[model samples]
Target: MSTTPSDASRPSLIRWPERLGYGVGDTACCLFWAIVSSYLNLFYTDVFGLAPAALAWLLLITRIWDAAFDPVVGMIADRTSTRWGKFRPWILWSIVPFMVAEIALFTTPHLGPTGKLVYAYITYSVVMLIYSAINVPYGALLGVITDDSAERTTLASYRFIGAFVGNFIVQGILLYLVQALGRGNNRLGYTLAVTILACGSGLLLFYVFLSTNERIQPPQAENSVRRDLRDLLGNRPWLVLFAMGAISLVYLTLRQVASVYYVTYYMGDRGLIPAFLLAGTAFSILGAMLAPWMARRVGCKKRTFILLTLWAAACNAATALAGPRDLVLIFGTQMLGSMPLAAIFPLMGSMFADTADYGELKFGRRATGLIFAGSTFSQKTGGAIGAAIVNLVLSSVGYVANAKQSASVLGGLRHLMGTLPAAGGLLVAGLALFYEIDTKREREIGAAIAARVRSVAAGRPSDS
Candidate 1:
């Protein structure tokens, strides 16, 4: 176990620049992911001409690989001790391979069904696993950055800002890039868009590596991997977080997959997709900025639950009510729906850090990496399930490749894009009800734990 300093002696503030840089890197990575998540299914079904079910299965199987790989990456990151810091080294080394794999995944050659599935499986699986190596550690690094609750919230806000920027770059710019590069060849457009994504992603990774420093150090503990896994599984708060994350995955995945279809098919205006996305992104940013204030005033759990539920209901109802002529209303509802998402994502990161602290207090070792890895694994699994559901639903609605869909199909697609996600969002909000860790409770726990650590280090014993 690592020795602890007294709470009174802890730093009052975290450096803002470091936090911003971290967010920048996170934004870049997420931008690339958003591109993949938002457009890849469409590309596969329409451009690559692969079966929707096949694509779904491929995504599902790759996620199994991601789940299997997460813990291993976490363990490796925890044990790693390079001059660059445990997490930073992974971030540093992963840049090239991550970019390369992303490019390859998007640039796969036109092939027959089996060949296309094989190409998708090999490239996507590799990209996911490699990305995990970097992402697990990066996620874990959030807890190590600061122990101050206020500072952590600030950091999370900046992080979400980066995420929003990344979303903007990908969803906003990449669409235009594809059109420019495709020049009538849709496949070429995807390939060029991915190339641009790779460059942006690489630059962001470099910025993160150059700008951030790891101020907090992990405690040296003598547990084997087996024991670490056991300790992680024993954490109740973290278990709840994982469940919540799964629900978030379902919500985000559905929204991403639906965006292209909603604008292209339903609205009959593919160009409007970027505008709708930007509106949603702007709303999400506003919501995230307000979240910390809301949490402090009403309590994080309560505010989260209420906001998410309302957002979900509004989103679903808007889709149900809007007709083709009511595109304005539909976009308005989407912007409204984004409010909770922006608030929720950043809060979720902070909550995971809180869970890490709780786990440390109970187990006497800091297993930040493992705890975050579990969260990441759950998220990836949920994404996989979401992808599967989207594919299956589209297929069931009689969607055909490179052809106009029937009215029934379009109706069903709208429902999946709108109501289904709203329901998933509500389900996640309901899960938030089970969370027992309020902001007040968390502060108390932090103080008690810090005092206990201080006493123990001073060769005295204290009951927390």
Candidate 2:
């Protein structure tokens, strides 16, 4: 927790390789994330033979546990003082556990329904716990890597490009690999697939640790846990981000997970899954590349986000208008819908960094770990709630696993994939109106924080 005066002066200090390294770390992380968010429920219900309602409970309970546990991890990370830095050390230490938990999560054991459910709970919980350990610190790393708001946005764009590439691999290549490698055994395919993904993710994380540096170090005197929590709670921008994280993730999760069902059941072609996902991921990559430019043009991140969100909503609605037999229309809408969303992740990450700046500017202390950990809580909670809601809706509509879906169930799948998520996107757009951190204001805040840091470093009283 020590930063030099040099670190304070240069806002856009990160080099291209460093930025590339940072983005690669997220690409690695998103491998597991893309698989779980896009396919875990389907894996449980279809491949693992768990009931939809039971699976719902498992997702809900585990995510609630994640929300509660994230802050403790955050607090520990903030207090951590390592040669490598506070946040990077966690990434170093937690990779093994994260790898182990991931493999266990996708491995199906030979057990009765009861035993299977127990196994799901055990494996998923461990994976999530380890996930929080690594990812919370990873998110916090963004703030410390560079205090430059514009550079952070650029870095976020790179990060989501990595994310889309990871998703493309998982979404486009994974199922086919599973089918090919498993031959006929889905369980085997999942186990082998996840093993490869987990191993690759570990290597990428190692690279992140080696290639990146944390520049925004904390003061030697740490804030008390209570004080940190108070500052976090009082941070208006962070609060907006927290709520936005959950709400938007719910929309994202439902739309992503439901697409599997939509293609498989409604379209009656399991082979199309890879193609559909690849199309969306490709378009998403384009969107990620375009985000910064779009935001600059629109005059602020919030406004650009709103425009993109509304565009996404329209794309989703268009998907709903296409019938089950309309393969071309479905694919077209999926690609179009996903394009704008590609911008959202990078924009959100950049904005979360802004909230950290806001917290420091307003509260006189920086708790990057705590603030980002709360964001992790919001994400897991939203994902869990969204998954649970999808499962419940599927169950209510008489969705029988591995059987031909009824018309009613097909309708439900379409709504889950399209209409509901579209509405959620609109809600996210509306909520963005309340968040007041524009690019101009962000620079103003960043400069002030830099001045405060310099004052404190020189043994003078900081006016903050």
Candidate 3:
């Protein structure tokens, strides 16, 4: 629990297995994550048979809860002092609850639409709540696990690569699995898939809890909620990341929801869904793998993020130009686009760790849990809005479930896939331009924070 001089003064080398486990933890989280992000829209509309407009209302209403709760959960996690550490205990607490909530969320009751809507509201809210419990802490782990800048980036890469593995498992094979396992009862198929994935997620998260440690402790004197909020709001680097996190999820959620409709309606092939999502997941993995190397090649993570996000934006926009049935053009453009979007996940994560340090050095408070909670806040707030917009647009364009889509609906899918997400990516690029923490500030902050922590532990004045 106490900091050693070496732990405070230098970058601690995270072992390969620990890094791998940290990554695996995210992979586990993504099993649930990808399920909600990729399939929940389709499941709610097609399988559960909810009307588009109704589902839009559901998403919009529930997002309010998501936006509000993440920071509270983060604050709780930050204040929690445990022998297991500040963040890891939440992972342990969440495993069983997460399993139950996820299964309940995906389950379809035989109630009427009104009753079912109520069921959805309660279950969906529970799932998102538990997800924040595990995830906000896990994300905060990145800042605490190691303060080394390069190691944070590497860990983030591992984290997201693991995330896409979960993404690939669900996105790539869930449809086929549903088809095979459902045997014409698609609802049962979904239930079965969630059950299997949920069990696996619990086990992997247990491993994450046992394997990881919260090494970089927060500063000793952070107690005021008002001051914490003020510091978080005032931190400029954090402000930029907060915006980027929101836009990034907007980009991701819109594209993910649109991809299904694009294949099912636009291409007239429901069968291609798995492969298309698989391709995107594969490219996402590749992008995550190359993120660290790409950052190194460009000699700066910030520049790499800007360049790659712009590239991804261009690729998404190009998809609009392709003919609906042109598989080659569609796949090629998306795969190209997915790589950069994927690349930015790690970049954004590492940059967040930087913000934690910068906020601490600048504001004299280390709200790692609260700061990282903003990442989840942005994700849920942004993702929920994006999902709502897509559904509402589908309704506005006269989308009908299980029937032939109108030309207006088909065209809307293209714009959702292309224009909206491209615009989100471009916004990410533009926001990165305003980010002020470069390598120079990273070192200064890391050093200053290290000295500050070291001095506190030694009961002396901080050289920082």
Better of 1 and 2 by lDDT: 2
lDDT of each: 0.78, 0.88, 0.88
User: Candidate 2, which ten residues in sequence have the lowest lDDT sum?
Assistant: 1-10
User: What is the overall TM-score of model 1 with all chains considered together?
Assistant: 0.95
- RMSD values, in order shown: 2.0, 1.5, 1.6
TM-score for each of the candidates: 0.95, 0.97, 0.97
The TM-score measured for candidate 2 stands at: 0.97
Return the number of clashes found in candidate 3: 0
Tens digit of per-residue lDDT, candidate 3, span 1-464: 12467775557769999998899998999899888888888899998988999999998888869778989988999999989999999999999999999988988999999998999999998888888899999999998898788999999999999999999998876777777888999899898879889999999999999989788766667598898889999999888888988888887889887788889999899888888889988999999999999999998888999999899999989998877778898999879999998999899999988888888888777888998898889878888888998998999999988889999999999999988888888888888889998877777777777677777877998755
Q: What would you estimate as the lDDT of candidate 3?
A: 0.88
**Is candidate 1 or 3 superior in lDDT?**
3
Off by over 4 Å in 3: 1-3, 454-459
Task: In angstroms, give how far residue 97 of model 3 lies from its true place.
Answer: 1.0
Model 3 root-mean-square deviation: 1.6
Deviation of model 2 at 187, angstroms:
1.1
